[model samples]
Every structure is written in structure tokens, then in C-alpha cells.
Target: MRVEYDDVETEDDLRVTYQGDLFTGEVVERSPQGQVIAITTYFNGMEDGLSTEFYPSGERKAEGSARYGTAVGVHQEWHRNGNLAARLEFDDQGKLLSRHRWAEDGTPIESFVAES
Candidate 1:
């Protein structure tokens, strides 16, 4: 179910709730001006799917996946100008596996992999 962020309350480690019950589905957060700022997916009260955040101008700023509140797979962040800023990968258990970063001008900044 789609819910406005302001209409929901956060409880116990940031679990989303609506009308005092754990929420499952999508929560949409909007800027004061009524622009969508973020969209998050939840399951059984925990983050469990793709979540995305946007810049004030409606450009995608970041996106990632999660399972039961633990980050998984690849997460990406972008500069407000829309250039890729960072990319991070995580193991199934949410351990950081690797990370790559770049400057807003598209210059490579850092790249790392876990010692495994």
C-alpha cells in the first residue's frame, strides 16, 4: 500500500507503522512542496526491496536493495548533477563486499574490495 511518509510513524529500529500497526508495502516521502523525495519498500515491517531517494529537482540521487532491513546486492549513489558518485556491493548477509567511487566530474576516486 502506498502511504505518505508524514502519515506514518517510525517504531523500533525504524520500522514503519501506520495507525499503530506494522506496515508492509511502499512508503512515499514527499518534500514540503509536494514533490516525491523518496520511495521505500517494506515487508513485515522491515525494508525488503528496492529503495530510492531523489534530489529536490526530481533526479535520482541514490538507490539500493535490502532484505529484512539488511542491505544487499548493489547500491548506487549519484551526484545532484546526475553523475554516478558511488557504487557499493554487499553480500547476502549485508557485509560490504566492494566499493567504487567517482567525483561529480566523473573522475575515478576510489575502488576497493573486501579481503576475502
Candidate 2:
């Protein structure tokens, strides 16, 4: 999950530098004005890697990881104020194993997976 490079076009018709990390290939979908609209990444065609999505204003929308194409790792989503909206977990096959959600003030609203 390393970002080789991005093919984003700048206002001057130049290629913008795409900065990426090793664990996940941080990809940013930009608008026509070179503003980051969405950020997404993948592993094996599914969201089984790392992804950090942002709002139009460059605020983090969601962030998480996956295994074998399943959400099987630490997943954290944030509100506009950067408060964790939800914390979730999954299995290797993308089955929901557990989840813990919160409001803007951090009230623990919880859930779990009951699969054999």
C-alpha cells in the first residue's frame, strides 16, 4: 500500500505531487480547482487496505483498514470537528466482528458481531 504517484492535473496543466504512505496508498480525488474532494485507496479491488477520505474542505471524513478485502482492522470515522464518530472491527472475510459508536461528545453506543 504505497503511493507510486498520482495523475492529478494542476491548474497550470502540470502533474501534482501525490504524497502516499507505505501502509496505505493515500489517493486524493481532487476537484477541477485542485481541491481535494475525496480520498480513497484499495487492496485487491476491495477496501482491504487503507483509506482516508476527506471532505471538500480537506477535513477527514473516514479512515480505516481492511484484510483480505474485509474491514478487519482498526476503523475510525470522525465528525467535522475531528471527534471519533465510530470505532469498528471486522474479520478476515469482511464480516462485522464488533463496533463502537459515539456522538460528537463521545457517548459509547456499542454493537457487536454474533457470527459463528
Task: Specify the highest-TM-score model's number.
Answer: 1
Q: Tens digit of lDDT per residue, candidate 2, span 31-93?
A: 566777665564333334576777667888887776534566678888888888988876667
lDDT of every model, 2 decimals: 0.94, 0.61
Worst 10 residues of 1 by lDDT: 12-21
lDDT of 1 by residue, 1-116 (tens): 98988888888688878888888989999988889999999987889999999987999999999999999999999999889999999999999999999999999999999998
Models 1 onward score TM values of 0.95, 0.61
lDDT of candidate model 2 versus the reference: 0.61
Best by lDDT: 1
Q: lDDT of candidate 1 vs native?
A: 0.94
Candidate 2: give the clashing pairs: none
